[model samples]
Target: MTFRRQVMIILRRDLRIEGRSGEAIFVTVPFGLVALFLIPLALPLDIELLARIGPGMFWSVTLLFGMFITFRQSAAESSSQQEQLRMLGVDPAARFVGRAIASALLLLIFELILAPTMVVLYAPAAIPGWPAIIPLALLAAVGLAMIGTLAADITASLRSRSALAPLLVAPLSVPLLVPAAQGLESLRTKNGIMVPTMFMVAVVLALAVAGVVTAQPLEETT
Candidate 1:
């Protein structure tokens, strides 16, 4: 098969399996909702504070929740007899890219549901530019997918460490998160797309390139 066809095959297989299991979105959506609900409780119900922090809170909550789901999304596949089947049926590069796309799409779904609820609950003074937020979500999702998938692959072989996906994912994700945080914060203050958009895009591009390059040997080693 051609390279694009191989990638699509892996994508189809993952979506079908996730559809059957149903646990992936089951876990992700509620986690996102809880995270969204907690922000008001954690701080005083001060409108000023909420407005000041809402954008960051929105990004942080969604990103962290996404980390959880992205890590889980591929962990099962990498650990089982399915790993062998994947190896037989797909090239390692195709497998990695396909898995990344699936994880990114899942994250996007969570973001779509989470963002509007954040607007209603937190009542930000103004929503960020939709154009910018869309790209920001997409780029962050890609970065999260790459890093989360790699960490999941690393820990999947360890029976006891299955629960450690977040622990492993969060630290590595800071590079992505920092730029994202800054960008979102900028969105709070400004009208037009802010400078941090460039930083976030750069961070996502760098991590994605790194993930693609390192995935092969690491997949074998883990």
Candidate 2:
């Protein structure tokens, strides 16, 4: 198969798997909602404080969801599964591209739905402009997807790797989470997304490069 075709095939397969299972709806979305719901109960009920913390909380929940999806998706590729794919002559590069695409697509969908819900739940004083968030969210999703996928790949075969995956991803994802959180906060405060959005674009580029370079190594290790 052509490289692009291989990537598309895997992408479609992952998407189909996710769709038929309704895992995103039943598991992922509900998990996010539960996390979000707990924030109010866990923290003080001060409205202004909640509003101020809203953006940070929103991205934090997204991060946890991103990690959850990564861990689950990576679990799909057990050692036997990797051997099967390799025997079928799947290119590691194409596999990475396909996984990154599916991961980002799912994360984007989650954020799109969750963002509005968060606005309604916490930001009652002002409706943040949705347009400004588009570029930020898009870049953030891709960054999270790529980073999480790579982390999952790295830890997939190790003993206790399920427990290890998030630890590996957390530090690498600092660049992603920090900028996104700050940018969202900036959006809330200054109504501007240009600065942090630009930083996120850079982050996406860096992670994309890292994904490409590491895909083959990851597959080999798996």
Candidate 3:
């Protein structure tokens, strides 16, 4: 099969497996809700503090939850002999892209479920131009997906690797997350609107490129 076709086949198979197992939602959704719920409880009932920090909290939680989910999802490969199958004929680059795409889709699903919950629990007034939040969410999720997928691929096999994915992904993710928090916080503070968007876009593109480039090594290792 052509390389693109092979990649698509891998994506389809992963999707089918996730659909059958229902592990995708089971893993991401609950954590997302917990994240939303915790923000309120952790901070004192000060409305100002909650409003000031809510977006950063929500974004961070969503990104983190997505990373954990992606790690588990990608690590599932080791549970079977699929890694060996890919070792033979598969183009490692294509496989990496395919896995990244699959993880992005899962992260998107988690965002849809989590964002509204965050808004409801924390109140939408905290975020100005609340409808414009979609781009921010998408940008953050994509960045997380890139970092998470790459980390997952790298750490899929070793018994302790799953624990390591977050350790690695989180530090690499801060550059992306800081801007995301700033962007959302700006929306909250009614400050400059453009800064976060610019930073987020840059981080998103950079992480995507890094993920694709780094995935090859992990693919070979797997």
Candidate 4:
């Protein structure tokens, strides 16, 4: 099969499984919402304070819960299922991209739902720069998805993968978190987002390259 075909098949298969399970929508998203809802309660009831910190809080929650979405599908796969894909001659790089894309889509949904909730709850003084917010969210989603996918792959064979995956993902995801928070803050401040936006793009590109390069070796090891 062609690489593109392999990617599509894997992507479709993963999405189908997630759709049926509703783990991302029903489970992860709610927990994320709850987390976001509780943040302001923990802080002083100062609206300005909440507004000022809202963007950072939103991105922080996203990075935390988004990692779970990346691992959710992979953790559900059995050894037999993985071996079956290998037996069918699926390319490891294609598998990597396919899973990353699926994770990215799910994370995008998570971010979309949380964005409005944050806005409603925090009510920041400045209107969000939707023009910048849209692409910033997309880039953040892709970057987090890539980080989570690679971390899941690295820990796939471990008995402690559940614990280890988060450790691996969180530190590595600093590049994504800092720039994403900065971009959102820039939106509020009317500051140009070029530097942070470019940094996020670079992080996504770097992760994509790293994922493709390491996929085969990781597959072989596992």
Which of the numbered candidates is closest to the native, going by highest TM-score? 4
How does model 3 score by TM-score?
Answer: 0.85
- How does candidate 4 score on lDDT? 0.86
Q: What is the C-alpha lDDT of each candidate?
A: 0.74, 0.80, 0.73, 0.86
The TM-scores, one per candidate, come to 0.87, 0.90, 0.85, 0.94
Sum up the clashes in candidate 1: 0
* Model 1 Cα lDDT, one tens digit per residue, 20-124: 766568887788889888878989869888877776787788767778777664436644565675557656677778888888888888888887888788777
1-222 per-residue lDDT for model 3 (tens digits): 788997797788777777876676786679778878877887788876775566667778876777876776533675446556565677766676677777778888888887777767766464447656577777877778778777877677678886787899888888777876676567667886687777888988887777667756655542
- lDDT at residue 219 of model 2 (Cα atoms): 71
By TM-score: ranked, best first: 4, 2, 1, 3
Writing each residue's lDDT as its tens digit, candidate 2 over 12-118 gives 98888888876765688789988878898988879888887777888889987766676665236767887888999999988888988888888888898788888
Off by over 4 Å in 1: 73-75, 78-83, 86-89, 127-130, 187-194
> lDDT of candidate 1?
0.74
| Predicted structure 4, TM vs. truth | 0.94
lDDT of 4 by residue, 23-96 (tens): 88889999999999888888878988998888788899999987799999533567788889889999999999
- 1 versus 2: better TM-score goes to: 2
Off by over 4 Å in 4: 73-75
User: Where's the lowest-lDDT run of ten residues in candidate 1?
Assistant: 73-82
